[model samples]
Target: MSCLKLNNLACGYPQHGTKNSELLVVNQLNLTLNDGEIACLLGPSGCGKTTVLRAIAGFHGLNAGEIWLSDHKLADVNSAVPPERRRIGMVFQDYALFPHLSVKDNVTFGLHKLSKSEQNSICHEMLSLVKLEHLGDRFPHELSGGQQQRVALARALAAKPSLLLLDEPFSNLDVDLRRTLALEVRNILKQQNITAIMVTHDQEEAFAFADVIGVMNDGKLHQWDTPYNLYHQPNSRFVASFIGQGVFLSGRINKQHIETELGHVACDVSSSVSENIVSENTETHVDVLVRPDDIIHDQNSTVTGEVCGKIFAGTSTLYTLKLPSGTELLANFPSHLDYSLGQEIPLSANFQHLISYAKETA
Candidate 1:
């Protein structure tokens, strides 16, 4: 069952120094989340991902369209439910816990309507769920950053919200800690069957935490898909560039294959070329998307590139190679097989799936 749905939702803010003028931050956006599913809105800064989150949380009003939580209507062009009235919870980036309050008190803050006994019971349950049962009596200042975040999550979940909104909740933590906490929060949400939508600029975090990811650009949703599909099968040039590390290589589409500087590679039946351009009588010029994993470092291959740059990444080394035509490509090679700058290295393409776009003219 779909737990949340946004239909043609448009949102914006007032333009500075202008009267009755608005600047749209989210335009004609549509998305859906299944029951207990976790989704993330991902994009670069100032891409309106946060605006969409605010809109869904009833912080911003819509210019058009509707917001629905199951069968209940939350907002539309003419009407909106107040934020407090909506059964939605928010987890902020700063872990907005009261410094004076103990962890147990923070989690129980939203259960004011319940009896004292109920609040304490729910608080204990939430603290246990977040694995912070031992720290219930400690104040926010006494806990580590990760522990504080867990407390914020516990507080949000204590209300038993129909939907949870996380606004870059892990951004303030260190990289390693962010990843670890993201996994922990994901587990907690999954165990409790919570439907959530998080807004973030980090693709790695999105990939790790979300069951589905929506990539936004310029107030528009470029793609909404699974992490694997977003990486292996992007829907647009921007999505292809934004989701992962890759470079576009010039190529010519010839029936079921694309001929590139690397070689003549067979296109998967699901490739855009096979689906959209195969019927054309003339060969089509295109820019083929090549990921680092698609490039195999081979010693006995005729194709070779000049190693221009390399970054050692513990288990693997990322090499930036310049072809004879001056086109730069990235290849991930094992750390043990060290290659120096200006060294000529043999390479071959081993694409699991092919993706290409029409050649863009200058």
Candidate 2:
């Protein structure tokens, strides 16, 4: 059975001059999260990623549709459950720790409902889960940012909630720590088989932590797919532009190949559109999505591109290559092979399967 399900849920703030006239932050959103699956809602600011999380947490009532947690309908009509009673755990961006409470108390606060012995045992196990068993006696103010966040996580998990909602939970930490904890938190969640939905605008975080990702734009979900599918077979141009690093090069398609200013580019989607163009006698325009790794630098290759810019990125070097036709492409090379700016380098595309959207023909 699905762990959490949202059917055509519409949630938003109210605006003046109209009865329920406020623009919907999340419009007719529909999705089902399987048990133990971690999904993420990814988008820019005001795109309703957090709004969706709040709605699922029962903090906000849905304007339409139904939500089910563990096969139980969650709606206003059915004696709406309060946040605490919903068995849903939340980890906010700021960690939202109570300054007055010590780490032990903060983690044990929710355990007050249980017997003293059970609560003590649960708290100890929770502390150990986050690897901060020794720091349980310390206050939130005394611990490092990462430790504080882990306490917050442990507190949420201690409740043994049916579902967990994390709203940009790693945004407060530094880059390196954020990456490390995101994976760590994912492992912990999986170890507990906790159904979780995390909200974030960071693609790397979403991809790293989530089993599936729902890419949102404006107030609608563009696509809810695995990270690999969302990255390689993006349903729309918006997702292609948003998910990964790349520059779109316009191309025209014939029977089995795309003819662009760069050259005749081969693709995996060639067969899908191959026969359709034979009878049309029209060129199908497309945007070739090329990531940095797709372009290989070779001294003897036939393709020549000028190095317009370079950024030393430790293990790898990112170079912005400009083709003779003024088309710009990014290529990443090992740090050992440093190519100066303005130097012409032979470039070859190693993209085995390219995703391209048809222009003027769709």
Candidate 3:
């Protein structure tokens, strides 16, 4: 059985108090998590990611559908098992460790069901799992932000809950610390074979931590897929624009390729599952998603554009190119090859296939 299953899940708060109309935050969303799998819900703020997390944790009652954990039906409109009784653990954004409690005590809080010796053993194991065995005596306030986050994780895992939920657990840390702690936490969770679902707006963290990612927008799941597929084959243009940086050049679907002002390019047009512009009439408008890496600096190619802007990255520099049509495109060039603004440079497409979508209108 799957560790967690959500079916046709719909939830919303009453507009004020009356039920005449509910402001729906989660709508007809279905998700399934297998045993020991780590999934992440990624989206911008106010996209119903947190609403789904709260619903799964039993904080908000569902307006429709059901939530199941393995064989147990934890929630439905008729009833909701209290969050405490669901054997589900949560690591809050603030690292909600009790101020007065020592790390050992904090880790032991949820292990009350076990014997004293058993609780101590589990707490010690959890501490070791989080690499905090040396700081068990310290209180939450005594530890650094990273340490405090580790303690919160240890406490959550101490009880060995059936599932773990992390709600932006690294949001409070700095950028470097966020990535370090996120990778460390992923290691710890995997070592324990814990099934977890994390909510985050940070793409880097989600990519580093999750085995599967569900990209959501406006309460709807756009795609539930691997990180690779989400990057390489985004289900919607929203995902393409949101997940990474790219420029879409307007073009038309031709006989066997896409005709554009830059040049004629050939790729799998069938990849555009949403847009079928390749009928008997090949004059359909489409936009090609040209990622920075897809473009390369080539002196031999006839195609060229003026350098609009540049950013110095350690290993490579990002160059912004403006086409003759005044469309902006980006390409990453070697840091050693410096190019100045307003200088026209030759370029070529480096990718084997191109991604396109039906052109958006003003």
Candidate 4:
């Protein structure tokens, strides 16, 4: 049985002094989560990632469709479960720790229904799970940002909720700490076999922490897929642009090849590019997505491009190369071979497969 399922889930916020006026924030959202799987809703601000989280957590009643936990219906148009009754745990971005409570007390807050001894037992187990057993007695203010986050996670888990919802949980931490703590938290959730859904705009964090990721764009889900697929086989141009470092170059598709200024890519580009690739004159124009790694600095190749710009990125250098036709492309070459600006260097594309999009209508 699926641990969580959203079927055509839609929601909107009501405008003041109006019965039918609502600004829709989520539209026809559908996704499924299996037991113990970690999923993430990833997108930019105002894209409804957090809105979906809140709706799933029972903070908002869906204007359409249903939410099911396994075989049980948790929410719908005519029926809705209260937040506390939904058995969903949430860890907020701010940690939301009670200043007056110690770490131990905060962890046990949700266990109030249980007996004192049982609460203490659960609290200790949660603290151990978060690897903060020694700091259980300290107040939230005394703990570091990461430690406080751990405490918040422990408290959420102590309720033994059916699923956990994390809303930008690591955004408060520094870059290095965010990476480290995201990995650690993922391990903890996996070890406990906790089914979880997180909301984050950081692509790197989503790749590191989630088993599957749903890419969102303005109030809609573009794709719900593995990180590898989102990066390599994006369903839409929006996803390709949002997920990675890429620059789109214009190309013409003829039979089995896409002819770009860089070179000819011998592959069936239709399936990866867009729907209905055929049109008049036996040719279709497409915008090809080329990553930095796709184009390489090749000393032996005859094709040469002028070095227009460069960024020294530690292990690898990012170069902006301009073709003879004045089209610019990005390439990642080894840092050791740094070419001066305005120098012409031989470059080659090792394209395994081509990805392109249909030309947008004017």
Candidate 5:
């Protein structure tokens, strides 16, 4: 079942110096989240991802389109249900906890309509759900960043909302903590079967937390897909560049294969080539997306490149190799097989998904 839906959603802000004019941020955006599934709006800062989140949470009104939660029509251009009535929970970037209130008090804040015994019961359950049962009496300041975030999550889930919105819920934490807490929160959401949508500029966080990810740029959603597909089978050039680190290797379509600097590797050239390029034309130029993992350090291979740079990442080393044609490529190899810079190392192309775009003429 569909838990939330955004139909032709358009939102924006007022024009700076013009009357009767608006700046459209999100235009004709459409997405759907199934019951208990988590989604993410991932993009750079000022990409209007947060605006979409605010619109769904009732903080912003739609210029056009409807917001639906299951069978309920929550908002449209003509009218909107208030934020409180939308049964939507929000976990802000700062983990907006009340410093004056204890963990129990904060979790029970929305339970005022229930009896005192009921509020306490729900608070206990929520705290236990977030693994903070022993910190109920502690204030927000008494807890660590991760603990406070967990409390915020507990507070959001305590209301039993139909949908939850998280806006960079782990941004304030350190890199390691951000990843750890993201996974922890994902497990908690899954354990409770809570449907959620999070907005974050960090792709790693999105990959860790969301079942579906929508990559946005310039107020437009470029692609909505799984982390694996977004990385492997990007729908657009922007998605291909934005999702992961890679270098575009100049190649030519050769029947069922793509001829590149590395080597001629057979691929489904017809489907992978850009629409403007005719796959039947063997001379048609194209730029193939080559990720670090696509390049293998094969000592026996005839093709080779000079090691220009290397970053040792404990278990693995990312080597920057410069091909004779001056095309730079990144290759990931085990740290133990370290090679000094300027060494000519044998390399091979391991094309998993041959993604290519038409070459632009200067």
Candidate 6:
């Protein structure tokens, strides 16, 4: 059984006084978190990802369905079982560390409920877990962004909580620091074997830190899968465009081969199912997702496109190409192979992995 399960949950505030006045923040949300797995709620701003987290934390009540935490039905409607009673640790975007308190004291604050010896032992273990043992005396303002974030993590872990909730924990850090802290935090959580639910709008962070990523849009989860599967085998067009860098183009399937305007790709969307194209349907309009790496600049290729723009990003160059049919596509080429702007270059779609979306379904 899963450690946490949300069954058809609907959460929102009632606007004004009408039966249909409830603004659905999370609509029939269903999710299951296995023990020791890190799941992420990812989407753009105002997608109700944070609301779902709050609901899970028992800060908000659900209007329909149910929530279970290890076989306990949490259905308190009036007075929430206070944040303290939930045994859930939280890390926010601002770090939320007490400015006046030292890192060690902050970590020990939650441990005060235990015996003196137990508090000391737990504080020591959490500090060690976040690699901030030596800087325990430092105040929040005195530490760097990464160090402060680690201290916040240490404080959360010190409680020995059943579950952890992180709300954009690295949003305030720089890009380089964000990347490093995400990896470090993921390592710490995995080492302790903690089950956590994190909310972030960053695709990179979700891909790096989460074992299962739930992509939310318009207050609903569209897809929940591993990072590799979400990228390579997207279930919907919204998922295909939202999960990775890609430009979707119109295409048609012909005898197990998909023919797009760029090129022909042969990949089975239904690998296990033995369902071919229905009778009298030779071509179906499918939105083909092509990544920047999929389009290759080959001089011997017959297809050519005009380079609309180019950006040198150190390791690779991002090129915006305009095809003859007026379709726009982005291509990533090695930085060593220099190309001029507005130059007509031969490009071909070399992607073996194809993700297709039916027009009606997408």
- Best-performing candidate as measured by TM-score: 5
Best by lDDT: 5
lDDT of 5 by residue, 1-362 (tens): 99999999999899989998899999989998999999999998998999999999999999999999989999999999999999999999998899999999999999999999999999999999889999999999999999999999999999999999999999999999999999999998999899999999999899999999999998888888999999999999899988888999999877777789888878776688864658354478889899999999887888899999999999999999999999999999989988999999999989878889998679
lDDT score for candidate 1 against the true structure: 0.91
- After superposition, the stretches of candidate 5 with alpha carbons farther than 4 Å from their true spots are 279-282
lDDT by residue for model 4 over 63-103, one digit each (tens)?
89899987789999999888899889999999999999999
> Number of clashing pairs, model 4?
0
- What is the lDDT of every predicted structure here? 0.91, 0.86, 0.89, 0.90, 0.92, 0.83
Tens-digit per-residue lDDT, 1-362, candidate 1: 99999999888889999999899988989999999999999998988999888988999989988999977999999999999988999999899899889888999998999999999999999999988999999999999899999999999999999999999999999999999988989998999999999999998999999999999999999999999999988888899888889999999877778889998898753455522444457878888889999999877788899999999999999999999899999999999989999999999899887888888789
Give residue 141's lDDT in candidate 5 (0 to 100): 97
Clashing pairs in 2: none
TM-score-best of 3 and 5: 5
Q: Count steric clashes of candidate 2.
A: 0
RMSD of each: 1.6, 2.4, 1.5, 1.7, 1.2, 2.7
Q: Which residue pairs collide in model 1, if any?
A: none
lDDT-wise, the better of 3 and 5 is 5
Query: Model 1, which residues run further than 4 Å from truth?
Result: 268-270, 274-279
State residue 348's C-alpha deviation in candidate 5, in Å.
Answer: 1.4
**Which sections of candidate 6 miss by over 4 Å?**
16-20, 76-81, 267-281, 360-362
lDDT of 4 at 293: 81
